[model samples]
Target: MNNYLTPNFAFANMIPVHAQGSRVWDQAGKEYVDFSGGIAVNALGHCHPVLVDTLTDQAKKLWHASNIYTTEPAQQLAKLLVDHTFADKVFFANSGAEANEAAFKLARKYAYEHYGAQKNEIIACVNGFHGRTLFTVSVGGQSKYQEGFAPLPEGISHIPYNNIEALKNTINERTCAVVLELVQGESGVLPAQVEFVQAARQLCDQYQSLLVFDEVQTGMGRTGKLFAYEHYGVSPDILSSAKALGAGFPIGAMLTTDKVAPSFGVGSHGSTFGGNPLACAVGCAAFNIINDQKTYENINKQSQALINELNVIGQSTGLFKEVRGKGLLVGCVLTDQYTNQAGEITKIALEQGLMLLQAGGSVLRFAPSLLLTDEDRQEGIKRFEQACQNFLSHY
Candidate 1:
């Protein structure tokens, strides 16, 4: 345990090794229900045969051909993403932060090219977690990640989440982009109001700024839709998607309409490992599987069931104030008395064979596999209850 080399993540003490569909086996062979899903990256669960086959098949065919020459898998993935979403063009990247970086750069470039330098400010919501990249960390409303990283990029501003009045007041001629997560993942799994999304879109249109949707945590059927933007019915001019996009494989994509696409011309921006064929191949397969209506419908059902069970547990134990979120991305807001126990509960849950996560303060977050079964969902909730009960008994 070298503290100097490793970064400090909250759950540093309890970590696991082997993983399967809805469960993982630790080094000591302790089986745990995996509710965290690698923070919403494992949409189809651990090592699904389909994804395994896709990855193996692609591995034999090709791995990397460099960005100079585009491969079939990359081209196919780009076309599929473009056809499915409001995007006319797609730029592949290696991670969610890279996707966001591309989206941010494109937004700024589009603004400067068309609307002048004043229209360079990027507006995001408070408590929203974009990523750990320097640019993203600064753009993110969370100041904690920005500490000691002085001289951050200027023109980034924060507005209240789900607040239309605040956005209307702040978003003016100088605004270049308004980035948001349809459901704020790191900030307590709060879904944005439909009206707020619409208003943001209208404001972007009026100001000629790009609307960037950072769908890294909510995309690829996490919300019973291929994309959360589908549920809101308000399309973003620029969208960044990652996490489940590759279904456990590392990949990301930034999508934009034709008008905003030209901002990244020949040498404007690119990534060496951005559109690697193997990643794209897996992404195509994952997209096809999660995009189906039946798959999403099952997700909706399981999400409701989990929420109901969590609420019942909360009512009985008086440990939670509320349970809210769309699909598998749920959060249990701890009651005032148990405020400090959020992290403690997660540790207890891990010890009791249930892996969980925390969002914001006093919120126990759950982002299981989108295709999690009814029985698995019940098992996770039941384990979580046991953890809560044990905590209550002790303290």
Candidate 2:
């Protein structure tokens, strides 16, 4: 069973054979309730009917015509995104990293054209996770990711997250853009304060720097809104989206207003497999289903239910310090007694037929499907409690 593959990922021993709704079965037929949702990519759950049908239908008609020609599905998907969000235009890519790369480039380009090269500096928050590309990794605030990647892209500076004074002190006339995630997903599901977000917008406006929101994890209804910025009542000049956009099909989009869209002129930026028909077709279906009032209501409802259950488990077991997040994107911080053991907890959860994720080494991350059912929630919670109890007993 030695298949040729890169060893980049620390893969689990269990091999998943199939999945339906919120449940997955391994090769040996052990069932596990999904609580990760493919790291927030599977918004509608595994093999959703609408998305599957859309992908299938588009697969028959067209697959890849490249960027030389635009397809109907791409056009429709772009329109849907534009109509729902603050964006006036859209640029498609294949993953969150590409979308973020496009965003970083667009920010620099906009600054360079409107101002000059000296204005190319981009300021991002510390501990923020953008993407894995060299430019994005550099723009990201974590030093661990940027180690040995020099001479990295220049003019990128980092400031403490949610610190308005630090942001104010750092951002100035030469700043090109200030990029941040509404909720820092990889850094323990820390949501940006509303006032802090407002200050960033105001400062960016004052300094004439563009405001960019990396919504790769918080977009497409993950944070109980169509976009997390909507909750803050502030809009970004540029925004990146990918996870859950196609309901598991690979797709990424960088959206912007008309003012900033012209900066990325023809021949300035492009992608070969971006905006393909197959991906856009599924994206269209997913958008239509997610952008409904009922869907938003359901997300808020289920988010509260899940949070309540996690709190109960925490109080009963005394393993959790805090549970914080918006909507379906939840994080449970381990108490000091159980610090830096999030990975160990997930490993034990796996053995108890539960799938989970850890944000760094201290917080348990839960990004479940928006349409998670009561039955799945109950079953998952049961397994999670058992796993937590087992972990406590062992450790």
Candidate 3:
């Protein structure tokens, strides 16, 4: 029983009162290890001292000086992102959707201004999730997200994900941009085959179209690499990033090369609250930590350990069809025998004092904080095994 006015979000009955590191306390004071990591947004974990110090310090000085005349924090963050990645320019926004929206718009604008309006077609892969905005939903692959929103944006087509032939048949010179997620996080934890990505890059190059990578979930060290594109050795002309950018402080950014950036000149695109001082301050702190080489080594070590443990669990109980994914963003793909049991598994995990997520009906998702400790990981595994055992005893 709650008093909030939301018919959209299916609110959980258990309300979290506080969190620290990779753990949360519910209203009843029950402790649960947060394997969800705020759906992969708490990159450095809850209340990392650096983020806390930065946000608090910025809050005391300035919180909301709009994008007109950028602040020092925003400048510092932009410089850091440009220095570390392939981006030559950056645009800040409030969420992943906004960042992606800007990326699409910028691509079309660049194609139109340089090429022509006839080149405005955009191609996205089937089963990929972008964001919830109308334009993004139209560009996104899932039909369910576009069901009620008809008269959707035209000139966008969906092709089978990771199918190079389908991409080859669909993409052409008319295409302005080909958008993709290196790892499909919503439909299931499916990674883009390296060959497919390389083919897409080649196709885009041949057609003179920009390649867009939606790294909203895969960026900021979720994939053991700072950005998933780094894993493939292919670079996108335009990129959208979020989730872990602010380390739970709520921020998103669209990055682009210098050639495509001018398309968003004065009055082209703007956000009132975007590039605000507070969010940028937090983002700067997060960027420094996640972009460090030491962070990647730590992520790789933890990721290997978790992958090994999950495989052992899968083999012993035969509950998981496969354990797949990279770094902290992992998924346990259920076999046909347990295709519809993801919900049950999640409920059981929660009761056992662990939080988990599901990519689809059958994939149990795990996106723990990058800073999740060895102790916490072992405790989470034990609890997870107990939950599976309880379910098996009844089944």
Task: Assess each prediction's global lDDT (C-alpha) against the native.
Answer: 0.90, 0.94, 0.92
RMSD of 2: 0.8
Q: After superposition, how far is residue 158 of candidate 3 from its true place, in Å?
A: 0.7
The TM-score measured for candidate 1 stands at: 0.97
What is model 1's C-alpha RMSD? 1.4
Give candidate 3's TM-score: 0.98
* Local error of candidate 3 at residue 50 (angstroms): 1.3
Error of 1 at 168 (Å): 1.3
**Maximum-lDDT candidate:** 2
* Tens digit per residue, CA lDDT, model 3, 193-267: 999999999999999999999999999999998899999999999999999999998899999999899999899
Which of the numbered candidates is closest to the native, going by highest TM-score? Answer: 2
Question: For candidate 1, lDDT tens digit of each residue in 90-151?
Answer: 99999999999999999999989997887899999998888888899988888889998888
Off by over 4 Å in 2: none
Off by over 4 Å in 1: 1-5
Tens digits of lDDT, candidate 2, 226-272: 99999999999999999999889999999999999999998999999
Q: Give the C-alpha lDDT of model 1.
A: 0.90
TM-score of each: 0.97, 0.99, 0.98
